[model samples]
Target: MNKKGQLIVVSGPSGVGKGTVLKEYLASRDQIAYSVSATTRSPRPGEEHGVHYFFLSREEFEQTVQSGGMLEYASYNNNYYGTPKKPVEEQRAKGNDVVLEIEVQGALQVKKACPDALLIFIAPPSFEELASRLTGRQTEDSKTVENRLNIARKELLCAKEYDYIIVNDTVELAVQRLAQVISANRYSIKNMKEFLDEVNKHA
Candidate 1:
């Protein structure tokens, strides 16, 4: 079957180990990419441009939005972030699975745009673990941490919308699960039925 490459949409709340899970998956796996999101926020100490995020200025980000360059855009805490569409399409065209590590809103939008894409949610084993992960980072203030916790609860509620919900107890395990999901999705009958049916026309 000549099927297009899969777009795996990974979504979860803050501090859910989603980033860690994806990073580990990337390190071990071949033929896939972790898409870089475009954001107005400044890069942190270790982040690289076009790797962690596009790190655009507010004007450039807004220009992309106005020009329809973004596949999906979301505003949180008054700043803007979006997924640039062209590069993702280009990657997928090369038969590589393009993983979009997006939040729930952008995930849903991708789901609508390409229903064939796989959607997975990475959740912590418990709320406490999630909270610890957030606070343990020591990146945000107490008030910001509190706000994230509040949002986390709400994001968890959308778990039912995804294809699979995998609790990330450890990075290795989560990456393994993600690999399994990708392997299984590649052979899903929905993506192969057309080819099978057409070839059996003489019968």
Candidate 2:
């Protein structure tokens, strides 16, 4: 019997290094599929459509949401961002673990839609560190940074709702922890039934 892939939902506050950790984790694994998100925001330099994001028009995005094609969606800074459901299903059908890097709201929606999904929350070492990371980037103004910090605080509160939390004090250690979580889940009883049945056949 073939093992079905697991759906992992990764979420965290802005500037928590969730992307960096996930990048490193995926680099070390071959069977994992990263779910690319769809957004109405303009693509930045070096970002390719369907690679970094599926850049969509407002009408297109709304149509997808209305058609129930999005796993989850939310508006940020007047732009809509969402995860397309088809790619995730396709990857899972191929027995490749699917990882989704989304915000809290989308994560929750995924949890509701797929109860077996492993919800992991990435956190900064501290609020001061989170603020420093957000400001040190120099990409946003003070007001923007403050707004992100405020949102981060609220998102942090939802961390308890997740199945696991990884504090990204160091990228290397965080990547290790994330890998361990996935590895452990892969061998979980819920995921092992098919393998056990195969063993019973040999027995």
> By lDDT, who's the top model here?
2
Give the alpha carbon lDDT tens digit for every residue of 1-203 in model 2: 44678999999998999999999999868878999999998987789998999999999999999999998998766688899999899989889999999888889888888977899999999999999999999988999899988888889999999999999999999999999998898887767878888899999
C-alpha RMSD of each candidate structure in angstroms: 1.5, 2.1
Candidate 1 lDDT tens digits, 135-157: 99999899989998998898899
- The C-alpha lDDT values of all candidates are 0.87, 0.91
TM-score of each model, paired residue for residue: 0.93, 0.92
- What value of lDDT does candidate 1 attain over all alpha carbons? 0.87
Model 1 regions lying over 4 Å from their true place: 201-203
